[model samples]
Target: MAMVTFVDETTSGERRDALGLDIAEERLALRELIRRRVLEEAPDGDDTDRAYDRAVEAFGRNGFLVLVGDRQIEELDELVDLGPRTEVVFLRLVPLVGG
Candidate 1:
């Protein structure tokens, strides 16, 4: 299993070890990682860096294994069985323009 943590492009160096994930018995799939980032208290300087650190710590702990999968708004409320050996992760992407 794998634990993923988010980091801004600027703070890529300090991202590791900040987010600890336990993956002894499970396998991790990157394609199905899903989650929403909600910032409660915005950091004054380098908010993305702070937010990434917090998000990694919060989501990577508790022996949780990430399983990537496809999800839609309609099936979001249902519990799916991707086999007993796998965990499910659903990530929602926001739209960006004028890159």
Candidate 2:
């Protein structure tokens, strides 16, 4: 299994191998990555299903950006090849008009 680092800008949190996903596979889907992230960071005792749904919605609304290394992921179905030292960054996107 490969290890990956996860970084969240929304909560300013960072973790190594947070979800324990099997990076041994040739590729992984963005959806699975988002699901794992939400599952890893969701508050204890909260409904995981709801949290996952919210995360997916946030992705659709451009609430955040998922970057693998320096490359931005644009689709939920996009497949990413994992490396031993891959770093995934989830950056919250702020709406400028709201300010």
Candidate 3:
């Protein structure tokens, strides 16, 4: 079992909010984590597929960053350990170039 704390953060290192998710798996793929997070965050009746697509797109475009503990996750398919108290931060990117 694992307790994952999902945090919404800004590029400037400011945290906005957080929520918790309890999962039975000890490890999960980053893409799956993103999928679950998107589902959890999306409002009722929201288009989850579209939202997930956007999230992945953002990840690829460096629009946001996913950090697990002290390490930053670069690949969507990367495996992540979901420990007893894992903190996963989604840092929304602020464009420094090519606006």
Candidate 4:
């Protein structure tokens, strides 16, 4: 298992081994990565389902930018090969006011 670092701009939070994900494979889908992240971070409660759904939606809507070791990922279905010390950053984009 490779060690990966996760950083989120939305919540300004950083997590290591967020979900104990096994990234030793040659490639990994972004969707699965997000799912694991949500599952790992979701709070246990009656509203856990709701929260998980919201998180998925956010990812689908491009609410955040995912970067793996300086490379920006464009699609949730994109496959990524993470390095041993890969750092993934989820940068939340804030919309600007109308001109």
Checking candidate 1 for backbone clashes, the offending pairs are 1-26, 32-68, 32-69, 34-90, 34-91
Tell me the deviation in Å of residue 46 in model 4: 5.3
Scored against the true structure, residue 40 in model 2 reaches a CA lDDT of 74
Q: Give candidate 2 misplaced runs (Cα > 4 Å).
A: 10-22, 97-99
Q: Which stretches of candidate 1 lie over 4 Å from their true place?
A: 1-46, 63-65, 70-99
TM-score of each: 0.24, 0.78, 0.92, 0.72
Better of 3 and 4 by lDDT: 3
lDDT against the true structure, each candidate: 0.34, 0.77, 0.90, 0.70
lDDT of 4 by residue, 1-99 (tens): 565667766544543334345466657887767766666677775465677677668877878788897688888789878767666777887666682
**lDDT by residue for model 1 (1-99), tens:** 333343221112322222323334333223222222223234456566556565455444422233234432223223333333333332322234663
lDDT of 3 by residue, 1-99 (tens): 998999999967788656899989999999999998889899999999999999999899988889998899999999999999999999997877876
**Could you give the candidate ranking by TM-score, starting with the highest?**
3, 2, 4, 1
Those runs of model 3 whose alpha carbons end farther than 4 Å from true positions after fitting are 97-99
Error of 2 at 41 (Å): 2.3
When summed lDDT is taken over every stretch of 10 residues in candidate 4, the lowest stretch is: 11-20
**Candidate 2 residues 9-53, lDDT tens each?**
753454334444446665789998777767777899999899899
